[model samples]
Target: MILVIDNYDSFTFNLVQYLGELRSDIHVVKNDELSFAEVEALHPTHMVISPGPGLPQKAGMSLKLIEHFYQKFPILGVCLGHQAMAMVFGGSLKQAPTLFHGKTSRIYHEGKGILKNVENPFCAMRYHSWIIDHEKPIHSDIETIAYTEDNIPMAIQHKKYFVFGVQFHPESILTPEGKKILKNFLEISYDKAHPLH
Candidate 1:
């Protein structure tokens, strides 16, 4: 099962639909409405933090969820969720060099983890005003995996956990390889949940 924490964003359902294509059991709850006890009951194999408005700090339960479940389950954070993951891991956020609402950009990645087998410089949809601050030192545990042409961080993953974040909206129609990205994430989640002996 997969749990999706909706951060009051219009794009949350779009992301859920994309996930549904690859998984049948998915539950979605608003960031503000979810309780830890309920999450404990769901026992999701993977957690997806949906993109939303405002700063990651104000994302309600989403931030707490990342702090609590990052080590327990596979996590995929998108946009605001991405920022929240970075913030929890000693990373900081700053206004992007330019706003990228409903825009597209080229993404260069390390071709590992969720990006494995993905194109090196793929086009992805962007819809964010804030980005992980590259000027400051990122947490040692947080490994940046992808970036834009301007060197803005595009994707990140934890060095020792199954936690991942992406600044781009892989659910958007503008992103051609959106399904592949989500598929890769699901594969990673499956491997973590059922590791080979």
Candidate 2:
């Protein structure tokens, strides 16, 4: 089963719809509503942290979930979820030089992990005021995999775990390759969950 942690974002359902294409067992819970013990009972094979308003510090259960399952299962964080993932591992966030809400930007990526087989400089939909600070030193375990034309960190993955984050919203119709990007993540999660398969 795939567990989606909703941060009260309007786009959460859109993300969930994409996930449903690849997996039938998906569950979404509000960030502030679920307890860790309750989450554990669901036995989620993979987790996705949805984008939303506010800072990572105030993301509630989403932050705690990453800290707990980053090593145990695969995680994909988008926008606010992306910020929370970085902050959990010593990365910092700052207000973007230009706020991008319901906008599109070109993303240059290393074509690794979730970005594997994706276009190197694909256009993606963006909607956020803050981003992972590029000027500061990122955590040793976190390897930046993608950046925008403006040099903002757009995607990241943990060095030794199946955790990943993308500043762009793959669920948005504005992103032409949204489904492909999400499909890659589901494949990664499946491979990690069933190593022998």
**Clash numbers, per candidate:** 0, 0
Residue-level error in angstroms, candidate 1, position 89: 0.3
Candidate 2 per-residue C-alpha lDDT over 1-197 given as tens digits, one digit per residue, 9 for 90 to 100 = 89999999999999999889888999999998998898889988889999999998888788889998887778999999999999889899999999999999999988788888788789999999999987888789798899987789999988778889999999998888789988887777545453311
In angstroms, how far off is 100's CA in candidate 1?
0.6
Q: All candidates' TM-scores?
A: 0.95, 0.94
lDDT of 1 by residue, 85-181 (tens): 9999999999987999889999999887788878879999999999999889878989889999889999999888888999999999888878898
| Candidate 1 global Cα RMSD | 2.3
Which pairs in model 2 have colliding backbones? none
Tell me how candidate 1 scores on lDDT: 0.90
* 192: Cα error in model 1, Å: 4.4
